[model samples]
Target: MQLDHVTLVTHDLEGTCRFFRDIVGLDDGPRPLFRVDGHWLYANGRPVIHLVDATGPARLSGGSSALVAPRIDHVAFRVAPGVEWRALVERLAAHRVPYQLTEVPASAEVQLFVALAPGVVVEFVTSLPVGAAA
Candidate 1:
């Protein structure tokens, strides 16, 4: 089966929205009113990322350094080919967001890894070539 969207908890709603919309280049859409505190973003009619405001003030999942752990990972989105990945890297740099480019096997596709915040990491991947692993 194909993968669906992923939700993340964030304290800054507006900032998170801006980061995903402006920096990441995801189109912003109207967020439906949910009982809880949060917002949603979609790409091609599929909800890709959902942001939820953490309930109350508690210590972060595993403190600020937790993200550095070996098991930590981020969500990645594949973009169409012929798209400029470096321009995205430049956009991240212009926004002062730290990132790296990693190449995966077989198709030789590249992924732009961008850490939006202390515990939030997202990647923009080059679309897989024809006949590549799905």
Candidate 2:
């Protein structure tokens, strides 16, 4: 089966939404009426990122609170090289978001990492032509 959306539980709902929208270029879109406060971030007409407000008393299946200490290492997205990749890099710099880059050995792909929050890291992978610079 194909991959679906990624959900993030955060105390800072508006800040998280801003990061996804202003930095990652995702659009704040429609979300169904759920009891919890949250937002749906869309990319290319699809809701790719779901943000849930964790400031309230919601608990997970294990009875633990959301984002008390995030267990996820990072979330990655495949991006186009050239213009798209460059634009993302520019946005990160413009917003002063620190990031690190790593080139995949034996592959034309490069991965860029940025920590959006204490435990929320975002990675962008861009594939370039062989022999092309990142």
In candidate 2, what are the lDDT values of residues 82-130, reduced to their tens digit?
9999999999999998998988999989999998887789999999988
Give the whole-model CA lDDT for all candidates, comma-separated.
0.71, 0.89
In terms of lDDT, the poorest run of 10 residues in model 1 is 63-72
Candidate 2, residue 50: the lDDT equals: 96
Candidate 2 yields a Cα-based lDDT of 0.89
Candidate 1 residue-wise lDDT at 34: 84
Record all residue pairs in model 2 with backbone atoms less than 3 Å apart, i.e. clashing: none
Clash counts for all predictions = 0, 0
